[model samples]
Target: MKTLSKKDIKQLNERIGREVFSKKDLLQEECGRYYRNKELVFFTLPQGRLAPSLKFLLKDLYLPKVTVDMGAVKFVVGGADIMRPGVTACDEGVMQGDLVVVVDETHGKPLAVGEALMGSEELLAATSGKVVKNLHYVGDDLWNA
Candidate 1:
């Protein structure tokens, strides 16, 4: 585990286009640390990039999200890729290659973070096949980490 310095936090905030942690949050609470292991991988969220763990922690805040039907929840939490047929809704402005949080329709809780394989319009129009490449999901090593 490695704690992020104030400079690192500032750089991360700039890269993500939002302040993820205040100095107090990091210094006082010791919350800005990166954990890495064979099962869990940690890295900075690159400029304009999003990670599943970050999305999960900030779900209450505004973020682009994709909703999958309940039937897909099991597969998603198991780290299976998202399929267009299972997607029930998507936030507007989600373009191809965008980072997206995957949530179940029942409770609207994030289940995974993924890269959009298609734009929102294309995702909604498709009737079948994969739509998002699952990067992280509930019950995965990152979640446990």
Candidate 2:
């Protein structure tokens, strides 16, 4: 478990809008007293946190090592309009602007990586609009990274 330094605690107080917890309080709040030596900590995004919140959690919260992968999900891919057709299926519980691993329809492998343009349910329901907003090239996507 990585303990916060004095500077880190001060910054957390400024960002979280509360006094930073002492080491013992942080141990309770962050680890529930289950201390481990692992450096890579896995955390679920807090409920109702949109893109801005994620950005803050990463940039300000010292979550330097994180896997933003949304795992498997369903959403429309490659369409002129986002709110219309082409949505074969999507995974579950994804939100807009989330970093996701877009899979290929044929082989079920990663086709590309990008931020979601709409919620999973919204993408499934709508027939047209931008769906998965492309971010980087993968498996020979036409766009440049």
Candidate 3:
């Protein structure tokens, strides 16, 4: 892994819509071309956007959230897209195409990070069909890396 330069870090911050990395040791890993600090990893999605790793989600969960029922926890952790039926709650202000965290209702622990397929109102109103596209989850390759 190589340390990121200030220019690279600035671009990354813009892509992820956050300015969390300033002086932290930012290392670029080859396993997934993920950017990492001492405690968190950030990965690039298929669309070329940066996303938070599950570990990062746990540490700084400022993203909008969607709570899933216990029955959905297994699928979520396995990287299944969050379905409408399984969602028990959705934070207001969630918009379509926004990054969101999927958490289990029992303990409210993040199970996966996903992209919202619909807005908060649409997610809460829908009865069936996928609502959030799972991006990263526990036991995924990125997680293992």
Best by lDDT: 3
> Candidate 2: deviation at residue 75, Å?
16
Scored against the true structure, residue 25 in model 2 reaches a CA lDDT of 35
TM-score for each of the candidates: 0.80, 0.39, 0.90
Residues forming the 10-long window of minimal summed lDDT in candidate 3: 31-40
Please, what are the lDDT tens digits per residue for candidate 1 over residues 6-109? 88767756765776556554322123324322222233344425353733344343558899999999999988999998999999999998888898899888
Using lDDT as the yardstick, the better of models 1 and 3 is 3
Per-residue CA lDDT of model 2 for 1-145, tens digit only, reads 4566656656544554455344343321143111113211122233422121222233234211111122222332332122224445666777876655444445544444456777777877776656765433332222211
Q: Give me the displacement of residue 31 in model 1, in angstroms.
A: 16
Model 3, 33-135: lDDT tens digits are 6566454478878887778888877888878989999999999998799999999999999999999999999898989999999999999999999999998
State the C-alpha lDDT per candidate.
0.72, 0.40, 0.85
Count of steric clashes across candidates, in order: 0, 15, 0
Ranking by TM-score: 3, 1, 2
Question: Highest TM-score: which candidate?
Answer: 3
Q: Compute the lDDT of residue 77 as modeled in candidate 1.
A: 91
How far does residue 29 in candidate 3 sit from its true spot (Å)? Answer: 4.2
Candidate 1: worst-modelled 10 consecutive residues by lDDT = 28-37
